[model samples]
Target chain A: MPSISLTLNGRSVSGEVETKTLLVDYIRENQKLTGTHVGCDTSQCGSCVVHVDGKSVKSCTMLAVQVDGSEVTTIEGLATGEELHPMQEAFRQNHGLQCGFCTPGMVMSAVDLVAGNPDISETEIREGLEGNICRCTGYHNIVKSVQAGAKAMGG
Target chain B: MQNFDYHKPNSVDEAVANMQASDDGKFLAGGMTMLPTMKQGLAAPEDLIDLHGIDGIAGVAEGADAIEIGAMTSHSVVASSALIQSDLPALAALAESIGDRQVRARGTLGGSISNNDPAADYPAALVALGATVKTNTREIPAEDFFVEMFETALAEDEIVTSVSFPLVEKAAYAKFPNPASRYAMVGVFVAKNADGVRVAVTGAGPSVFRASAMESALDGDFSSSALDGVAVSADDLNSDIHASPEYRAHLVGVMAKRAVDACG
Candidate 1:
């Protein structure tokens, strides 16, 4: 086992993991943050997307040992104890999710996209969200949600 | 995924040593391809030598007439570098079109070239630019590097260090991506080098290859219209679920023309 220390959401966390353990596995299993789903073991699916050092990455594709000192933000970290994140609120208001299987990753990816480039256009949003896959909602409401979320965040 | 002893080497020597330590060991670059393959049970190595920690393999070198890029340099880094954008905008654009942002962040040029995936975008750029792939042991010309699908001339223990591309007057890359996988269904790279012109085609073939006929036409007249009659032979191209060999052949001409137009 290799011991690693890194910032999780806004808090610094440390743990020991098997060298082969993926970042998604570590986050979902060891840390007990089950919000980030694992729809596909392959990297092709973006259902396991998360933020690594401010950039969105598919946690499933990366080994936890590879991100020894990087900052990670998952779906579980988005909301305050009582208040939903603006993106989350936008998703709720717009009915962005149906099955909700791919929502956590979509929300996380959308939040990162908005944070990275606040003044994002609809075309850019579609292109940016290309990494993420949503089997439900047909992406119309999700796009509206992200657009509204960006506006709500003063982006 | 098969269990393998993992070693993260901090330096190139350590990486080389780790690779030489076991016959069944494979150097892990971006893990974009390798990890997925391991997970699918397609490849199971006895040892995995992680190469991301080696600083010497992750930088860009600028020269008066060319650029030498470390193999481990991420696609995102290549896409955003001011030097690359100004000097080789086509290459930068090609880098940007690969996979998605997440894959670009972790995938490296060396990893992509070494893997020699037939549908990869970088090989078309490299072959079109006539780049030189430098490994830890020796340098191999791009023409001699790609042997076949998922195959290269690189020895088992030898690791790619960098690739050098001679600055060209104009160049561009164009590709039709498979909607499902986002891998190139067909990609064409057009370049105007000191040696007149070279056109490389990828995704449509068993391996990335130069389209001499297209290069000849463009060499005769460096314009999209010059390729009006040029035909890419369907003989050696790939016919997969995404595209028929005939369709890929047609795409070769269309993409090459698009690249030529963009080059201007």
Candidate 2:
């Protein structure tokens, strides 16, 4: 077993895991952070998206041991107790989710996107969100949510 | 997934030494391709030696006569690099169009070349630019490195350290991507080297191959019309869900023409 330690959702967590244990599994099982969804076992669907050391990564595509000493922020970490993060609030206000399976990853990816690029347009939003897929809502609300979130974030 | 002992070496020497320590160990660069394959139970290795923590393996070096990029440099790094953009804009474009932004950030040059996926873009650019792939043990010319699909001439335990591409007069890469997967259906990279014109095609065959007919035609006359009568035999081409061998052959000509135009 490989002993891995890292900051998850602003808290430091360490555990011994199998060499092939995925970051998603560690987050869901060990850390008990089930907010991060795993839609496709393959990396095609970005439902397992999370920020690794401030960059968006598909958690399903990475091993838990690979993130040792790195910072990981998931959707559950985005909110402050009961108050939602600005992006989450914007998504709620804009009705950005449908079935909500992809909402956690979508919101996490969107927050990173908006933070990196503030004055992003709709086309840029679409391209940035290409890695993230939303089956419901036709992506209209999601795009609007990102735009609104960017505005809320002064982006 | 097979059980494997994982080692993240902090230095290049450690990585190379670890690789040489065992024959069952595989050097894991960016796991963009390897991890997925492992999850699908396609590959079952006893050990995985990660190369990410090795310093200096993820940078772009602008040399006097050529640009040397470290093996672990990601596609996003290459695509956004001002040096790559100015030196070879088409390479940047091709890099940007690979997989998507997520895969671009994770996939590395070394991983792509090591995997030698027939549809990968880096091999086409490497071959067309007459690049040299430098490993820990030796340097192999791009033309000789790629042998077949998912295969390379690299010996066991040989780790690619860097790739150096000569500054060309002009170079361009054009690819027809599968909409769903974003892997190239047919990718053509054309470059005007000091010697003459070089054309390399990927995604259409079992390995990246030079388009001799197109190269010969363009050497005489560098024009899209020069490729009109030239035909690539479909015998060795790849037929996948996205494109038939014949369609890929057609895309080879079209993308080659587009690359030539872009290079001009």
Candidate 3:
């Protein structure tokens, strides 16, 4: 087992895991953060999306041991006490979700997108959310959510 | 995924040493391709050398007439880089169109080129832009770096340090990406430099290749109309469920024309 330590959400976390243990598995199983979803075995689904060093990355595509001394933010970390993140609030207000299985990842990815490119347009929001998929909403609401979220993020 | 001893080397020399020490070792980049392949049981290396620990290994540098991108640099970094967007917008566009945002955030240049997937977009841009792939030991021209599908000229223990891209007078890339995977069904990268016009085609062949006919025609006239009658042979092109060799061959010409038009 490889001993690894990284900042999760806003706090420091440490764990000993197998070398092949994916960051998603470590988050869900070891840390007991089950909000990050694993939608597909092939990693095509963005349901495992998380912020690694403040950049959006698929948690399933990374090994926990690889990020020994890095910062990671999962879906579980989005809310502060009673209030949800702006992106999360936008998704709820705009009905950006369908079954809610992909909501956690969608919100996480959306927040990162807004942070990186706050002036993102509808086309960019659609394109930016290419990694994330929402089969039910057809992405119309999702697009609005991202646009609104960008505004809420102050840009 | 199999149990492997993971080594995070602090430097390129240490990485090389760790690679040479292991019986079956593999260098891990962003794990975009490697992790999926590992999950599918396609590869089971006894050791995985994580290269992200090495300091000063991930960044882009601007020079007089060329841009050097470190191997660990991710697709998103290249796509969002101001230097690349200003000097080589075509390369930035190519990187932006790779995989998806999540994949872009994790996939690295060295990993993509080192694997040399036939459908990969970077190989085409590299070959067309006349870039040089620098390894720890030596530098290899992009023309000779790619050998075949999933193969490159990199030595067993040698690691790709960075890719130095020489700025071209005019360049553009256009690809017909698969709607599902975004892997290019056929991608063309057209670049006109001081040397001449180079037309590199990917996804259509076993590896990225130059279109001499299109290059010559474009050399005569740098316009989409210049490629009007140029015929790309289907003889050596790839045929799969996505498209036929004949279709890919035809798309090669079509994409080349679009690429040329995009340059303007």
Candidate 4:
């Protein structure tokens, strides 16, 4: 086992993991942060999305050792106390999800989308979120939520 | 993915040493393709040599008439790079259109070209733009770098350092992306310069290839309509569930036209 330390959410934590252990597994199993869901074993789905070094990445596609000293922010870190992030609030207000299995990844990905650009169009949002797949809601509400969230983020 | 020892080498020499030491060592850049392939049990290397730790392997250097991009540079970086967007907008657009936002954030230019997937987008751009593939040992022209499906001219122990793309007067890339995977069903990259016109077709064949007919036609008339009479035969093209070789050959003509029209 190799010991690795990284900044998770806003704090620093360290753990031991095998060479092949994925970052999502390390986050969920060792660190007990289960909000980051793994919907697809393949890299096509965005269910395992997370922010590494302040940029969105598929957590399942990255190994724990690959991001040893980097900063990783999971869906669990999106809130301050009880208040939801603007993007999360927008998702809730716009009904961006149905069963909510894909919401965490969707919201995390949306937050990055909004943060990366000040002005985003509906088409860009659709193209931007292509990595994230939601079986339900048809993405109409998700697109609406992203537009509203971008506004909420002061984009 | 099976258990594999990992080494983060600080230099290209160290990485090569690590590669030579292992039974079957893989140089890992972004892990966008390699990780999933491993998880699916398609490949199982005994060792993984992570190259991200190495410095000087992840930046862009601009010359008078060319841009040298390090292998570790990610697609997102290349897509949004001021140098690339300004100097090579076609390359930037191609990078921007790869996979998706998340995949772009992690996928590297070197990995994409090295893997040489049949439907991948970079090979077409590199081949059409007449780029140079610089490895640890020697520099290879983009045309010779890609050998066959999921294979390149790179040796097992060699590592790609950077690729130098000579600036062109005009170039553009257009693709008919698969609705599901976004990998190109038929992608075309067209470039024109003082020398002549070069057209590379990807996703329509076993590997990226030059459309000599289209290039000659465009060399004569520098217009999309110039390619009206030229046609690519479906005979040697790839046929899969997503698209037939006939359709892919048709797309080759259509995408080449769009690419030529978009060229500046």
Per-residue lDDT of A1-155 in model 3, one digit per residue for the tens? 88999999989988689998988999999898999999987888899899989888889889999778999999878789889888888988999888999888888888888885667988888888889877788889999998988888875
The complex in candidate 4 yields a DockQ of 0.90
**Local distance difference test scores for all models:** 0.89, 0.89, 0.91, 0.92
Q: Compared with the true structure, what per-residue lDDT tens digits does model 2 show for residues B1-264?
A: 877989889987898788778768888888998899898998878889999999887899998789999999999899999998998787788888888667787889999999999889899999999999999888999999999998999988788999998999888889998788878889999988668889999999989999998999988988888889788888789987778889888889899999888877
Worst 10-residue lDDT window, candidate 4 chain B: B55-64
Docking class of 4: high
Model 3, residue A130: distance off in Å is: 0.7
Per-model i-RMS: 1.3, 1.1, 0.9, 0.8
Candidate 1's docking class is medium
Q: After superposition, how far is residue B233 of candidate 1 from its true place, in Å?
A: 0.7
Best-first order by DockQ: 4, 3, 2, 1
Put down candidate 2 lDDT per residue, A1-155, tens digits, no spaces.
98989998899888799999988988998888899998997798899999999888899889999999999999999899999998999999999998999999999888888885667899989988888888998999999999999988886
lDDT of 2 at A27: 92
- Taking the tens digit of each residue's C-alpha lDDT, what string does model 1 give over B157-238? 8899999988999999999999988999999999997789999999999899999988888888999999998999988889
Query: How large is the interface RMSD of candidate 4?
Result: 0.8
Residue pairs with clashing backbones, model 1: none
What does the lDDT come to for candidate 2? 0.89
TM-score of 1: 0.96
Better of 2 and 4 by DockQ: 4
Per-residue CA lDDT of model 4 for A54-119, tens digit only, reads 899999999999888999999999989889999999999999989998888999899998895657
